[model samples]
Target: MEYKWVVLTNTTLGVIMSSMNMYIVLISLPAIFRGLGINPFLPGEFVYLLWVLMGYSIVMATVLVTFGRISDMYGRARVYTWGFVVFTIASIFLSLIPSNSGNAGALLMILLRIVQAIGGGLLMVNSTALLTDAFPPSERGKALGLNQASFIVGSFLGLILGGMLVGYDWHMVFIVNVPFAVAGALWSVLKLRRTPGTGVVRLDLAGNVTLAAGLLAISLGLTYALMPYGNSQMGWTNPWVIASFPLGALMFVLFVLSERRAPAPLFNLSLFRVRPFSYGSIALFLNSLGRGAIMFLVVIWLQGIWLPLHGYPWESTPFWAGVYMIPMLVGTVIMAPVGGMLTDRYGARLFATLGMVIMALSLLALTILPYDFNLFEFELILFVSGLGGGLFSAPNTTAIMNSLRPQDRAAGNGMRQTFSSMGSTISMALFFSMLVTFFTMYVPNEISSAVASYGLPAQVASFLSSIPASGLLFAAFLGVDPASAIPQSVLSALPHSVVELLDSRTFLPSIIGPPFMDALRISLYISVALVLVGALFSWMRGGKFVYEESAGRPGEGRS
Candidate 1:
């Protein structure tokens, strides 16, 4: 198979657009919530925030394989073109944003964002399949590596750009997509070639619906689980959480059975038959999981704790936080394609394994740092982690895609994407859970003791504790000073000394530093374990890309 630069360019554009859409809302979230007059840190608000952030991911994750399968059957360019159009329309609607200052307005944005996610799913599902088809097997690693780098680079810039755009106008975050989406859509209509599927199989609509439902249920359950439950810190024990998780899992089991029977399965379970494909996918899952939560964690650390502590105001936290995150870009810029080139020569095992080890070391590095850590030390660590991530991502993705039969590229790419997306969303949930659990078990006591140390009354300290841990939690998540997110009434309830204590940068940092650090440590170990295990799987994704017979006779399998 001959690979063209045009195909890579188009695919890279798709990757950038889809990925940028993911985090643009992230930096714009605080501003968006504020515009809607919603207290972003309030109880139940995190639900909206999570959806706006994860809804696209969930939709993409759920439908990616299905869409990929459809693209294979319907012609990849057909699905690809439609996705660009749909995504653009959604972006327009989001920018208009009927209202954001009230409950109804907020709900409108969420629904529209879900629409946007559907479009993104289409784009993401087919783009990799398209790229894989265009590139030869041997060159696929470098192609995928560069594509992966483009994806992350888009994300990296999205964080910084989103912050900047949203700071000036929240709507700009959504509006910014207009030009690119239009160009991509028009270009696809004019330039993208149709490559149709080979099989005469039927679409497994039932399997698709079941699996999508199952996955959506899990996401919904996990999302709501972040909310508060009575006097507890989080709603993990809530009925919705308890019921949704099991129901989703059960549906997934049923989905498996249905897939085994389906003639044209939405996800070709047979892809797992290849050891390298299966194992590489796991490593991809781990790679995403290990890195996913760091953005939120780092954002909180910078916006909520460090930057504010250093004198950046609450309103400016988002932009400055992005500025502080520049090191990640530096690392990826230098390492991603380089890693892929190295993988081309040395095989994927040792280099990919080392990358994960580097990531684990980086996580350990972050786990040990103080709340108000030094910049150069922290930036260096972030860059190294990004380097590792860049190293792992492309070669691993290349191996997974190349391991598959040419006919199965769609399903294969989709499966890899699903696992990676699930890993990210799950990582977010896990990190938040760990962070909140630690806060719940210890923050009250610590806050109380701290308040008491500041000579506050017992009643005042207790009242402060009663005002939902989520408020302060989001305060930290949003990088806002806790005093700012608090309700006027709650502030009134607190003693003069306690309010003063809570308002101080040092107070929140001093009290939160230890508990949050504990959570970070646990999260670090989890990431380390995942990366190391992923490295092993990446190693096992042995041999060079061996093309399927269906990849024409010219399918290049070796460098």
Candidate 2:
């Protein structure tokens, strides 16, 4: 039992580490770009910036199912352990990126992020399966709950940790993972036992390749779409994004057919045959879409709007933003174990439903927070929302994993993870699109007015306006100093008053406030709806994790 606990703990820690880094880049973006001495506002570099942020999620989404399938064929622990190794190595490589100028530094960071994504995919794909093998059906919820808790907790902490470290140095974002990675690797090798899987497993090469290619295309398209096209603040009209949609869709369609025909499929189509698994997977996906987007959006809102407007220095915003976010993390940590334990005894439906309901209320509450709101009011709501998500995650995961047959556990978990990955990736594209659209509608006039107000030459105002509001929004949102992102030549020529106005927190937020609020509120409405939908599906997931011809009773090997 003690040994099993060790295994679960190490594995969960690796997962947490892998996932935490996913969004750490968001808070640290300002520092990273500044460290690299790159102009974030350059139109061409916008795609790279978006890619650096979304690349890991994109890669994870593309490969999670394939890796999950492969893990079942070999060994879950074997694959999971390798993920930690690869992740650790990748972290070292990522940390080594020196502050070179131009595309070299940017490209290096994006490429390293892609590699980290691969490692993350390996870890997540096999997570549920490995836990399924270690814990009994009944206890799977609580176990997975704690694991799920770590994921969310890691996500929230990633922002906080990024703030703390990035102010000291941007490389700290990647370097911090080293000790955790090494520890997880050492513990995994010693503590984890292999649970042998059944059947003659042949690698589904075609299925894997097609699905990966399809998802990658979509991700690439979406990442680029965040760039400015022509005079547009966003690139929705880009030919590449337009063409890739059909191509990716066609490839994905082929992937499904290939999966159906393959003798040993990467994605076992049969897992969806189980009612609880299917519904639970769908609910998890929807909630994740809404949840994931909000996480990024909120960070932007806090750092871009609230934190700066509240008087924190641009460099100080990252740390203080993370500090303010403590309520969310603390609340999640406190609720996870209790929620998991409850799901073990009471089943997942009630808690998950109520939890989603709580999530809905929290989103609605967030809509009312002022751009420069009082901390106490905002923190109180963030804590409640965090608690709500904690409640929903464990029970929902418990139902999904426990629904499938023991032999199909890996595949089932993989499918669940695949849906989840899609949700998170899609969240980035959708949220960014909405925010950029808002930027276009709301920011141009304010910027033009500010630019002209400072007694700048007409050509200079024209030039600054031409740089694109999306770039400026990204700069502010990431907490980058306006002076750094813009050209020094332009800065020096511009009147002092205009420069200060352009640099001021009040100027950016006021211009962005209305439209950003429009999108933010609408997104919250969608989130509320999604949580309700998830709750309904969770409720439909039957009463218990009934295992027919299973390996062991609930809590058998679990500590």
Candidate 3:
């Protein structure tokens, strides 16, 4: 077999493993909490839940650029192999975590996940550079397409795979990654060559510190901003959350200044001068921002609303939600390679712009559906969105990679991944804030009225109405019954029929659906607008331009 094929296969495997880990724990969180003997909904425990969900991504975002620069200074293949080793070891520890260890177990899980994220960051920052190194310019689009397709497919598959594995035991979810990681590590070590670096060994200490600090602050703020503040549905007003953004921005400004002065900068800000690289990155950020939260929204839609309203039990909703999203996987699988191959022939600009346009239209289509939307309609819209993602991802990534000089590939790819990751983090915070805002406006009255009509006492109704929107959404997200949060004494005092109704799967969904959909429509509209702007930026990336050392600056002469 050819060396390029080996690179492709190994890199794809690494990406799949890394991407799957991101979502596997997400879907299996309920089971994980159960195994830990902790309630995620309890007052102090919510922080643990937030950390578990956001920690990996935050760590990945913070370190990607640093890892990328390190790969360039050392050797891409060597650093990448080390990533597999670290990830494999972390998976082993995660799987063996003692059950019923309570908060200690949850903290241990979070710490291990942070370690896993470090490995994932290494793989992500260098994989594209390695692929770009191995493949010819003409074939890079197809190579990257297949690699990126695995990433998206793996994330979706993780949802289903987690649901399946967690049914028997939550430990199985982490255990499943060990064999793959071990094989990948061994394969990487034996087959991959360590390409020589730029020979400039000095590290950019200032740049690294500033950039990492900035991203860390920003990520933490976004994560915590999803929590409720005093008398508010979200924590946007919290002094810590409020301070984090400007401080992060100030740190970023300092990072830029430090980079300009550094002997060896972590990020090559000059690369932004390349039109395709710059425009493609902006488009990528916008597209990611628009689509990142769709999975969470759709999952909540299925698990919290549609499935329950249609009589599926709450415990089964998480698994079935993954099953229903199969059409999206199919769409991505079919379109990603085709889009990449076609971009190689016709140039990335056309395909990428068209993809974002399709994305905007599909997102717009979703807004027209009622809360009790037709299943076929929902699936069809999701499939279309997936197709748009497939079409855009490979070509856009190919364009950005192709426009960079060989020496700059790792750092450039790292910078690109940073944008994508940060966009996703911010998107989750932004969309969730929007949802919670709408929930605050509508849910309290809806809950109070529903319970009142059920003949609950005024105090009971008041207490139910006062339940925080974030808690309710988290309950819905975890596929736990909302009534589980009620005090046992209160539940026992309620009439038998009312108690039955309160505990039933349909009750929360019935009242929550309308408010959720109202928020969802507004979010969809915002997504449409974001994607449309992304399409415009994609169009601005101009014609196909591949960098060559002799070709002068990137946009001067097309390869």
- Say which candidate scores most in lDDT: 3
Minimal lDDT window, size 10, model 1: 550-559
- Each prediction's whole-model lDDT (CA): 0.75, 0.75, 0.82
Clashing pairs in 2: none
Question: What's the TM-score of each model vs. the native?
Answer: 0.91, 0.91, 0.94
Model 2 weakest 10-residue run by lDDT: 550-559
lDDT of 2 by residue, 16-58 (tens): 7975786577778777877887765777565666678677776
Kindly list the per-residue Cα lDDT of model 1 for residues 1-559, writing each as its tens digit.
2246777888788878877777677766667777776664567676766666666666666778877767777788888988888899989988887544566777888788778877887888788778877876667767777887787777876888888887688888888777878888887877788765554557788787887788778877776776787776578889988999889999899889998988877777766767667888888888778877777787777766787668776678777777777787668766778777776666666667777778878888888788789999999999998887777766676667666676777778888888988788777766776677677788888887887677866665665576555566565655455666556886787778767766766666666777777777788888888888888887777676565664543234442
**Which stretches of model 2 miss by more than 4 angstroms?**
152-157, 195-200, 231-233, 448-461, 481-495, 550-559
Reference-based TM-score, model 1: 0.91
Q: Is candidate 2 or candidate 3 better by lDDT?
A: 3
Give the Å error, residue 77, model 1. Answer: 1.6
The candidate, 2 or 3, that scores higher on TM-score is: 3
State the lDDT at 327 in candidate 3: 80
Ranking by lDDT: 3, 2, 1
Off by over 4 Å in 1: 1-3, 98-100, 196-201, 230-233, 457-459, 479-507, 548-559
